[model samples]
Target: MEEGATETPEELLAKQHRKEKKDLQAKIQSLKNAVPKNDKKRRKQLTEDIAKLEAELNQKHEEELKQLKSPADTKVGEMINGVEAMTVEGGDQQEVKQPRVTKAQKRRDKKAAQEKERESRIAEAEVQNLLGERHQEGLKLAQKLAQRQLQIREISSDGHCMYRAVEDQLVQRAVPGLTLVLKELRSRTAEYMRNHADDFVPFLTNPNTGDMYTADEFEKYCSDVEHTAAWGGQLELRALTHVLQLPIEVIQADSPTIKIGEEYDSEPITLVYMLHAYGLGEHYNSVERLKDPANEEDS
Candidate 1:
């Protein structure tokens, strides 16, 4: 066995399975945090999704474990023969000759390595662009956040940025406000907007019809906000202020700060709003004081 190669194939496989399961659990927990308590239908759908992934993962793991129990473990043989092995013939053991590595194979391997490196470079560039280096904004915003002993917590840009940004702050800060998760926050915001139609409807326009939303269309819009993963905007932020009754502050690179619900007299949940942080456009990320107060200098 090579140095540091302590675990058997079965044991290594088991360890890998455990790590995968841990990652899955973390994702499920996030989903649970995002789903609203009162939305039974969505909750049920999430439950089914969890079952599908978990059951399949567990079953495949069990099957692999059973396969590893067999005596003809090819993986073990492969490991033994990987570097050096002997062939037994007529009660005598002889060293097996190593196969010559051809020039063509070496060229192919070198080409594959180059392709991988190119791909990695492209991915890094994309990430840097999405992080606002093109506009030189992330550094400025990050510096400002650090002043408050805070740093940015990036939220997924999957059209649910507004709600997820709010969700992150609530959980991260443990704010003494609404116990709503991401889905619940969506529900409450939609309901608030619907109830205060006079305040919100005037600002809304239906892009499909190219007209102001009629009464029926407005109702449908609210329904979509509650039930769908529709992208959120300024109107939704206003509704959130009223629903959660907590102030929200948005910091930007080259603009004035946006403050909402100042009347509530609560700690404002700060979020960084980026106009050029992503190719898909606008994104939101939560901000909080550095987790370790003692490490403030390093920040």
Candidate 2:
């Protein structure tokens, strides 16, 4: 016999079904033989697994039967419609076949898809360009202040960028492996907001609707910030300052310098701000590090 032969789709499907059924049956039998008779929970689970596997095997058997009954020459669509025979007894009627697609239509579709992909890439590049420009501007300011060159260490821009950025800073400050600790910071911030609702609620406002957050809305927002991968905002930043007991200074290219948290006599970790666009609008970029020649070699 030939070592390898091309199998039709039906043959491949049948082989897959047989292998799956065999494996499932073996698993069920093994479970039945090993599970303790006195353990009702284990026995019940084994029984359920067996029943499920048997039902799947029966369904596969039915499908295989249908495949075997289908005529070899019949079109795939006709076979799917349960047409076992392609011709009538006298061959008086003929089944009409679908018209083949034109080369021009296929070419046009391929061109349109490519054009859409190109446009998407172009838009992404434009956004990255904007961010890069803003980042350079911040570096220039830092360099001017220190009278030396500076470099940026970027953080992941997922909604958790702020937390991750703080994590990076903390790691640099000798608190290594702070990933899980940073995640819990969200919960701590939420707890603080809940306790001091009066202090923060008045400042909370919906950016889209231009309305101050209601008590219920603010509660839901805090919940999302705590439990979900919601984007961190100004309130979370303030909370983080308190939680870490470190002052945060935001350096933006287009805005005045802003400081959050308790006043510190010492220099605080400066985070460069970059603009990131999501869909149609834009949001602030999370913490980015600045390094001069002194730290560049170590970095």
Candidate 3:
């Protein structure tokens, strides 16, 4: 009758069964005590009542146990079984299966892959074009400026260098290369003297014998010559300036307002053309002269 003091049907049933069992047990004990004092009828009634209560209790317990072990409780086990079936042979067969791509998606992927390959090819071609133009231009300029042709040689396993017509020119230009050459020559000389005194000094005396040392030794002596030729950089800077027909400072310095004819000042289209020509060793800042016949007469 108290508020919120309600027992559910299952709770009430359990409570009733407990009370009945307790009462039957008490009655049976009393009957046993009386049986020793000649109360036969009371003992028989109590025994019947106890047996009936016990039967009811057994039936109720069996029903409760059945409810506890019902089909709903086996759902987790069923789910596990299903998963094992899928992995081994059942639960999520579709999930275990490979995903299928749509025809439209496949087409799109193919198109994208093709586009990427095409762009890669175009980029490679552009770099090759630049290198080809530069090689040709260097060859032309070597003849014009050095009066000696330039030969592009792979002097190492992977490195490249432009030699002035002949390998001996490396020795002539060795004075201008760099401190790297100086340090290396000194190091090699020291190492050589330590290892073979007679062979090294005599080797140093012979200009060709210097070449007997590895490319690494020869490189340091050559670096200073190249550096001096550009004043501070390399012949490339000189070559670039000469090719662009611009002053050394214009190319070397950073400027906000680009001069049209100078390396930094040209229009975007002109810059591209100059880049191409500069690589080719024929840097021209303007295509305007080509467009204008009158400009040719003025030239």
lDDT (tens digit, per residue) of candidate 3 on 194-269? 4443333233332665445454553443443333221112223233333333332211111221223245452221
> What lDDT does the true structure give each of the candidates?
0.72, 0.60, 0.36
Ranking by TM-score: 1, 2, 3
**Model 2: per-residue Cα lDDT at residue 6:** 38
Worst 10 residues of 1 by lDDT: 72-81
If scored against the real structure, what TM-score would every candidate get? 0.54, 0.46, 0.19
lDDT of 2 by residue, 92-139 (tens): 556666446466545644654575476457546534643565434544
Kindly report which residue stretches of model 1 are placed more than 4 angstroms away from their true locations once superposed.
1-135, 175-177, 208-210, 291-299
On TM-score, the stronger of 1 and 2 is 1
Candidate 3 residues lying further than 4 Å off, grouped into runs, are: 1-124, 127-136, 142-150, 153-181, 184-299
Indicate whether candidate 1 or candidate 2 has the larger lDDT. 1
Better of 1 and 3 by TM-score: 1
Going through the candidates in order, what is the number of backbone clashes in each? Answer: 2, 0, 20
Off by over 4 Å in 2: 1-150, 175-180, 206-211, 264-267, 276-299
